[model samples]
Target: MGVGEFSYRISISTLIVVFPLLFVFRLAQGQLHVVGSLQPVVAGPGDDVILPCQVEPAFNVAGLTVEWSKPDLRPDPNDRLSRVDYVHLYRDAHEVPDMKLPSYIGRTALFTDSLREGNISLRITNVTQEDEGRYRCFIPKLKSQTRFSIVRLIVDPSLTETVTTKAQLDPENFHVPDLNEEIDNKGGSSERCRLIPVVVLCVFILLCFAVGGCLITESQKAELKKRPI
Candidate 1:
């Protein structure tokens, strides 16, 4: 074959091999799944906790809509509106307050920093016993086989009780003077007081010695005067 013809065949073969690889890579990348913890997440009442959920193969989901809901939660039958309420709703780079459940209105949030890393975990602040249940994390626009994950939350009241008991029993909570330390402080003050009299006595003794020396010197001068011619 001519050099030009051989080069043309080589290019065709390279494209054939490279195109399949590119297609397979794209397919695999699109198959990202939403994953959640298999174990139940435990927390104490009045504590802040995060229900872990993330997308596998890590795709940036910052612009996408995320829905967090309780699957078993039933709609309010008394309300005429047939809309489904969610625990938390995020869309268009902001949260939708109107779509959130009334109880979770101010207590639920998503980590803005982790959104770019495909972490869609929901944070619940001041968790209560009423907040214990299964949570669903979903990405509606995700092109994946599994676009949702379930996370179970458990609020243990005993944990909070234990914490309160510990706080009540903690010695640092109250100031109590040590008996030995108080005794030592009083002894130190008495010792200092006892040294004052000794100091005054030493001063008085020194003054007496000075006066006696002056008197002796005067007597010696008189004797010298009497002996002179």
Candidate 2:
């Protein structure tokens, strides 16, 4: 073969062998992603809030280690793995106690029921003003750090309080008399008023009877005293 022809044959062989291997290699490394919402999750202080996160392609993640952390917390500089006190961590289908931060131990929980559906959402109960910040939902086994997403949390105290206040102050919650009921109550009052005079008349009649009996008894006693003494 000529020089150009020989070079062309070698290039074709290399392409045939290299392309299939590259395709297989990429296929073996399946895509693992942690997807989250772009919008800030608004919550009130002392309210339960859900930080939504899901694994893309809907793979069962019951065995995988999932971590939810506040990015603002100071990370340990000496740790090469970049592991810090995580807000919540799930491993081997259960929550790991030692891996969780003290503040987040009782407050955070994962939805284990949705793990089969690739949902790794974190629920934070009794959220405080300090809980407002960026949260990262990550899986350490997923080699690429870019797969994890950040969720911004916002705590609106006034908005929640206003809603609670409005609920408490609702007209439906107060005792408002109906028109028919008010009329019935008025009738009842008039009936009670009418009964008062009747009761007074009966009492006066009883008093008159008692006085008459006393007078008769006294007159008899006076006659008896005059006769017997």
Candidate 3:
């Protein structure tokens, strides 16, 4: 082959190998997307709460690393600490006890069965007021890149409404009886006004009848007084 033809063939072979590697590298660098609740989660004291987080475009998370930590966990300024505690940790489909914080060791658990479905939700049982804070759910380098979701936690005290008995509710406290009497008086006045019109109509009819009877009697008496011719 000629020198130019040889160089061209070498370049084609090099491109064929290099292009796929570059494509794979680019695919590996793709970012990981995570999803979580937009609203803050409310948990009553001494209750269990689930902090929901999931991977978008679901992929097998069984072999991946899942880390749950409190972003707003502030230690005392006097305490010496190089790193904050992790609430829960899973590496290669198993819990890493050494990585778990002392306080969260027994109270927190991950739902492992749903890992294939891409659910990385953490359940915290026996929640306390100190558990109220923003938590970070993260997966580091499972496929492409590190992904994170934020969860806001709110702790609320249990509430109960007091029910009042009938004895406690006094009827005298309300002016309902006086108001009802006033309404009845107004109704009676309206009825009396309606009866006035009816009474006037009846009196006019009686007067017309009396006048016709008197006229008939006078005509009959006059006819009787007139003798037959």
- Stretches of candidate 1 exceeding 4 Å from the true structure: 1-26, 76-80, 161-229
The positional error of residue 203 in candidate 2, measured at the CA in angstroms, is 99
* CA lDDT of every candidate: 0.68, 0.64, 0.63
Q: Write the per-residue lDDT of candidate 1 for residues 58-150, one digit (tens) a residue.
A: 789999999998877765789878766889999999999998889998998898898999888888888889999877787888865456766
Q: After superposing candidate 3, which stretches have Cα over 4 Å from the reference?
A: 1-31, 74-81, 144-146, 159-229
Q: If both were scored by lDDT, which would come out higher, candidate 2 or candidate 3?
A: 2
Error of 1 at 170 (Å): 35
Report how far off residue 3 is in candidate 1 (Å). Answer: 25
Q: Alpha carbon lDDT of residue 147, candidate 1?
A: 64
lDDT of 3 by residue, 18-135 (tens): 5655564555344345556666677677777788777765777988889888866655678686456689999967888886778787888888999998878888887778888877
Residue 166, candidate 2: C-alpha displacement in angstroms: 22
Error of 2 at 114 (Å): 1.1
Report the poorest 10 consecutive residues by lDDT, candidate 1.
Answer: 181-190
